[model samples]
Target: MIQKTLYLLLFFSSFSFSQFDDLDLTPADSLMQEGKIKDAIIEFETNYQKGNRDTNYLYNYACALAEDSQFDKSFAILRESLDLEIKLNPLFDPDFLNLRTDKRWNSFEDELISKIELEYKTIIVDKEYAKKLWKMRALDQAYYFQIHLAERKIGKNTTVVNTLWKVKNNINKENLEKLEKLIQQKGFPKKSLVGNNAVQAAFLIIQHADLQTQKKYVSTIEDLCKKKEADSQSFAYLYDRIEISEGRPQKYGTQVKYNKENQQYELYPLVDKEKVDFWRKEIGLSPINEYLSGYGIKI
Candidate 1:
């Protein structure tokens, strides 16, 4: 019974972690981008009233309210966010500046600090230090995607080639070295040794590694999944990467290119076009249409 309870907590925490982080800007998000704070607040606050639980939406709604000088109401919404245990750091946010003059701000920040400590304690759910390394790699993967996406955007502004990508590339290389040493000393950080979520993070980072680097760990990754140490999702992604690199069509349509003008995603070559969905289903992936929905591609 105790073991079952721990598994339940781990599952819930991992699910919440994944759900909140996979965010893309919505219409309300665009409103915030365009500085239409009131309109954005109206849209976000309406969702909140209907019991929307997305942390980004809640925090942005609070910020929009603050921008509209709705200090008291913003405080109310922010407090609700605290009940959700969302990561709200007051110091870095300019939106909360006006509320800082109020005495309530001090107490609110203290409550936040306590929650933040508790949150970390929860994330460190696994006893193995490999979970910590995987978390670092997960962060690196996220940062890598952000840098890559931002660099892609820089081209539209007619700037000299984006230099930050070079810096980020260097950082990735450094992380690669760190991971290499870790793998040599400890072997592939199988999700079985840590928590499933930690191995999920590890697989995510492995996806971002160079093709040769991926090749080195592919067998171990496959072996672990066979033993129930890792899930098939990352294996599908990693195998697809290898297939494409070797000049073969990928069984999984994990690779895609976006056509900005048409707002559609063009899938990479498939080993068997008609059988693509079959392979995806076998590996526990959603159908291509469902997967591409997040990219704003039309089905």
Candidate 2:
């Protein structure tokens, strides 16, 4: 119950992302969740063929084919994904376990990541720190979000929080130092100057930082957002989280707290509850009711 709530919260957390951000998955993912594997495979393959070999579509198509027991076809699909320069998940996904016994698995796995590095190498013209920060911040999010799901068969739920925290912390320190200098030398790290991805990376680093750290540049980020340089959605989301963590009410209803006894995540107190939906709409967030449907929330 608590675990399910965590998953729901995680799902809703994406509400804070930019409206223009690429969705990680699609409705076809629900077909897989519903155990209609064949339907999912067909949909994934259709999407892959329709797009310009969108690696996301390609990767999922490969996973679905493997689950359907078509190893040869699956491997072929994965090769297309690699050629598309898809970033591979390091921890082997269970969907590909069946293909792991093949002798070629080791080399294919190595080559997949090598190709991702090659792709990164191509992003060095300008805002190179943006690309570097983007990769680090995204990996940090994955590690933080996957913590609850990491468990052993011994029934003990384990975590890699410390390990992930160390990595995130070091990167955050570097980002903070660079950002402070950037603010003094120029203005805030904005799209015209630092590039869009770097600004996004800056917001991501601040989101995971402690309150005192976030406070140091909250106004600077907000100013950039007003200039239409940084993202307003990200700014509001970070502010809401920081306020909630400090026992203050959230303005956007973007944060929630788990109710252990009820086995759910209830909305955290809001500063102006009636205005939340209005603000959410202005920022392109879905209606709260629609967003909370996964948790069986009505109000």
Candidate 3:
């Protein structure tokens, strides 16, 4: 009887291990790495439905979807992954920037950011209470909030940009000073309140009152971006935006030019026929140019 019981337990354990081993994601990852995006998506979706919806599986699904150009679905899943565990290590994840332009992405990001801000507010309300509870919750929320904010800023999302600006506007001088001091000493800005407001409070430091105040936070953003392997287009877009903001002409593709005199950016064709065809296809302007003409560019 004892021998039979032991055998049964071993069989069950092995069965469990086999189940996980079968969905190890290595094969799907290889497909992704090899740029066989469609195959990877099918593999990942199959396993994800069969296995536990953990961060890794969700991330893989999101990545495969993005690679397959299913931007909306990919963004949704990535946000779901973040929601499961609010904190994530962006240094190791490359899916954030890939979904930047998806309309649904920003609303989800804002919701998460709001939650992070709330968590931060909780800390400020009572330091002792925060010290006890914040660490447990902070890891997920902080990491998520931090990475999301960084990505949005780099992606030049005007809504997020305005939100950060608003946060800075609301912070008082005394709290700002304290937060600055805390950041200098502890490497992260101190929150004056805990809860959803905490992220807003922290944003004050990043936005800063002046260029001198922004120096430290700017360095932090630079460091974070450097640590991650971001998409080339996203990186180039950020680089060009920074240059343009600093009164320099963006030196990228010949398709676009910044006109300092008019304070407007204009798109000029490198190859007139090819560019016209590309624009037409992009905006569905091929069959009817009039409908898209109101979109500010002529194909």
Candidate 4:
């Protein structure tokens, strides 16, 4: 009976470890949905420590940290998530769009972009291998390569732009022109699409056109942004324009904001009373309007 009980105990122990092996992101996700950010952070940290470092868990952890008003910690976690995603599957990683503007986020993105370019160059040079593997890997690589380029343009990462331009110079002029147009049409100047890199590529075809042409493309973007029709790129663009533009940028809290009184950017806490005191005491500025001086209200 003792031996049998020991065997059962060992089995259950192993089973429990296996169950938690991948850092089940569900609890953190649920807590986030319920606005239990501190609790979610604790759960996510537990999972992260268990080596379940998937992108979703990392993202959720970062989100939880942000919701708890820990901006620097959240950004750090986001950087980790971006790096892991790039390393695991550059072809399908959707974390890039989330971290474009973050200074720390850019370094990892640049590294991945560089690696993809190098890989692409090597593939192009190996004609014999390319011919053999073209059916299997060529389309996938091409698709990802195009996506990386599109992301660079949207993020206004000048190095990426120059690299993409060089790559474009090597491709057919018609294709390059198409890409340019798409960039203008999709407002690549404003945002990065996380998942649907292909749609961003399509948008690159007309991203920099005249006003009338841009207006024409807005409908196309609207179509892309529709829930039924939306992929990551479309949803990302829409999220930036609508949600992020409103206060979702602060959803994962940030310190930087334009101070209308001081006419300078200031880092203030999410807590209203502290933020009010920060403006008045730290900056020596009087509140012009009480209505505009709180959470979700950007100066």
Q: What C-alpha lDDT does candidate 2 achieve relative to the native structure? A: 0.60
State the lDDT at 244 in candidate 2: 78
Best by TM-score: 1
The total number of steric clashes, by the backbone 3 Å criterion, in model 2 comes to 0
TM-score of each candidate?
0.58, 0.57, 0.33, 0.31
- Cα lDDT tens digits, model 2, 1-299, are 11011223322252121111123446556565455789988787677667747666677677767768788888898788766655544223445655665677766755654565477653323344444444444433433322322222222233454564466467556756765565576555667654565566667666666679778878877887788888877787788887877889988777765688989878777788578789889877777777667556556
What's the lDDT for all of these models? 0.60, 0.60, 0.43, 0.41
What tens digits encode model 1's per-residue C-alpha lDDT throughout 1-299? 01001111111111111111223566666665545667888898788888997655666677667667787888887777657655634333435555666777667755665575477654333334443464344344323323334445565243433465555567556767777777787776765465555566566556666778889888888998888778877788788878877888878777666578987756667788678788889879889778767556543
Q: Name the lDDT of candidate 1.
A: 0.60
Q: Rank the candidates by TM-score, best first.
A: 1, 2, 3, 4
Candidate 3 lDDT over residue span 1-299, tens digit each: 01001111111010100011223436676565444679878887887778758776676677668646698778777777767766422211323344544676556545654565475442245443333222222221222222234444465366665564444344334445656666565545223333322333344333323435544455454443354311222223233344444566543321244478987645533224444445344423232244224234454
What clash pairs does model 2 have? none
Cα displacement (Å) at residue 71, model 3? 2.2
After the best TM-score superposition of candidate 4, give how far the Cα of residue 207 lies from its true spot, in angstroms.
14
Per-residue lDDT over 1-299 for candidate 4, one digit per residue giving the tens place of the 0 to 100 score: 01001111111010100011123337666554444667878888898889987775676576556546676777788668766554313222222223333565445544655564465442223322222222212122222334333554465366665676555444323443544454455433221232233343343333222334445555656555553333333332232233323354421122334678967644433335435534343323335234234333544
265 in model 2: Cα distance from truth in Å?
1.0
Candidate 4 lDDT for residue 270: 38
